[model samples]
Target: MEKHVSVKMINRFDTCSSWFHHLTNKEMSVKRLYRTDACGNRFCPICTWKTAKKNAIKISILMEAVKEIEGKEFLFLTLTAPSVSGEELCDEIDQFNKAVNRLFKRRNVERVVKGYIRKLEVTTDQEKYITEKLYKRKKDYYDWRGLKVGDPNPTYNTYHPHMHIIVAVNKSYFGNRDAISKSEWLEMWRDCMNDNSITQVDAKKVRATETSNSNAVLEIAKYSAKGSDLYHSEAVFDTFYMALKRRQLIVYSGMMKDYAKKFKNGELDRFKKENEDEYTHLLQSVWKGSTYDSKLRELTQEEMEMYNERAKFIEEGDEVE
Candidate 1:
């Protein structure tokens, strides 16, 4: 019997490999916070968690500056193309990124889109799973070329690469002459993709105002692909790791570029000043289902004392590593 396995679910069977946490207390509030350093490696699940937290902060800061503009709005968009085999995976991502750049350059899209942040992502359709018995019984039938799975085409069981973009547009864009509706956005995406291989595409307007909610923007800033989705298959992992080598996974353009520069110039102080009563700290966490366990339970007396000492140093203007 052919066993079905999910590429996305393989991480459920794996445990967190790294352990180290840091905590901090709010300046004017009693709230405590925790966070950890992210290695920023594409294949590390533990680091993926940390990266998501860091990215959320970054996107939030950007949105803070964005909301300052009078008529600007945000749109969360998912852009996709045809799935390609492992061999073609690397090149396809490059093509997809180039196409996205071209997409923004178009008069129709450019007229409405004032700025954007884009990230690349990938997924696989797990066709079949091989059992030890089957491998031993028909050892000659399997090979690294994906032929062992029955398809002679070595490129079978391909990787699906796509982009999740957060676009900033003028509030008037929806009613403008070049305004793109949900359906029109998809068609424009296909036209930009410029490949017969592309058949499925999607985009929708998301709430990104000052009052509604900003979680949508934060979600768009998360990792290009989940660690769970990439860690199961060696072919997928290696291909992606090499393909994205030296590639900029996230990009910001237009007025966003200016804001990003300000952020790089230590704009974190702005966030701290704005949210003085909030705590931002590190934690030792275990990845659960949808989120990680970040709440600090009970602390030993010694640990509590150490935390207090560190907090005192931070309040005294001494940098704590």
Candidate 2:
């Protein structure tokens, strides 16, 4: 399955670097380093990596900024609804977002859970996630949570589209008479969605003692969905791609407004710049986009060497805007 996905991805991004200009200065001396054009296709693995890293850094900084506030606690919440076919996938995602926004706006909810960061995630139905473990001999490879699988195809069966939210709450929340219980949270979520048919909602405290690696905030700060899952079926991938067309994957509330602005305004070192002399001469290897026995191949060795010899490096201060 993974192999098939890789083949498809490589083919899809075969022309990613079809055209690129070497980093150069006003003097036209190219730097040793070069960058490929990000295709910006949502399901494209390469583009997704670049986007995820940028989001992670932004989220981490926001989390740090808010941690200094008193009475702050984090909760890992999962909200889900019934699966939808390819036709309904896009609509369902929009509805999901609306319902979540409604859940947060409720008077009772705002008193306790003051702020939140929500991320959308999708996984293969139960059979693909659960039963596939039989193929692995190592027990550690199995998913121990014992989650049930659902349909594999988005066109026919229900495809799982859910949100994993890192909710911030006041430390004194439980002391209030109106504080909600775990079950009540689930009920409220169901009611907000206006559909009591699907009953899977989770809300749990994310302890402050937890390590950054295990912290719920950092976990959901990652990619919106697994790349492998999107590779399952083109129909499913298309469904998600269309649904998330203009959607914001991760969102922060209240205190994060200023932090978001700073990050977006280039106040952060989102992308590392290579020192001027990191490499006097660097090899530039890219796909030629020509077919070789029905497979895309990198530039020939001679082509790479010739290009490297002609490229010139410039001083750091001379970098072009």
Whole-model lDDT, model 1: 0.62
lDDT of 2: 0.60
**lDDT leader:** 1
lDDT of each: 0.62, 0.60
Which parts of model 1 have CA positions greater than 4 angstroms off?
1-21, 24-40, 129-156, 208-215, 267-320
Clashes by residue pair, model 1: 33-281, 34-281, 34-282, 34-283, 35-281, 35-282, 35-283, 142-148
Task: Report residue 285 deviation for candidate 1 (angstroms).
Answer: 12
Quote each prediction's TM-score. Answer: 0.66, 0.64
TM-score of 1: 0.66
Error of 1 at 91 (Å): 0.9
Q: Model 2: clashing residue pairs?
A: 125-150, 126-149, 126-150
Lowest lDDT sum, 10 consecutive residues, model 2, at 312-321
Task: Give one digit per residue, the lDDT tens place, for model 1 in 35-75.
Answer: 33334444556556656666666677776667664367777
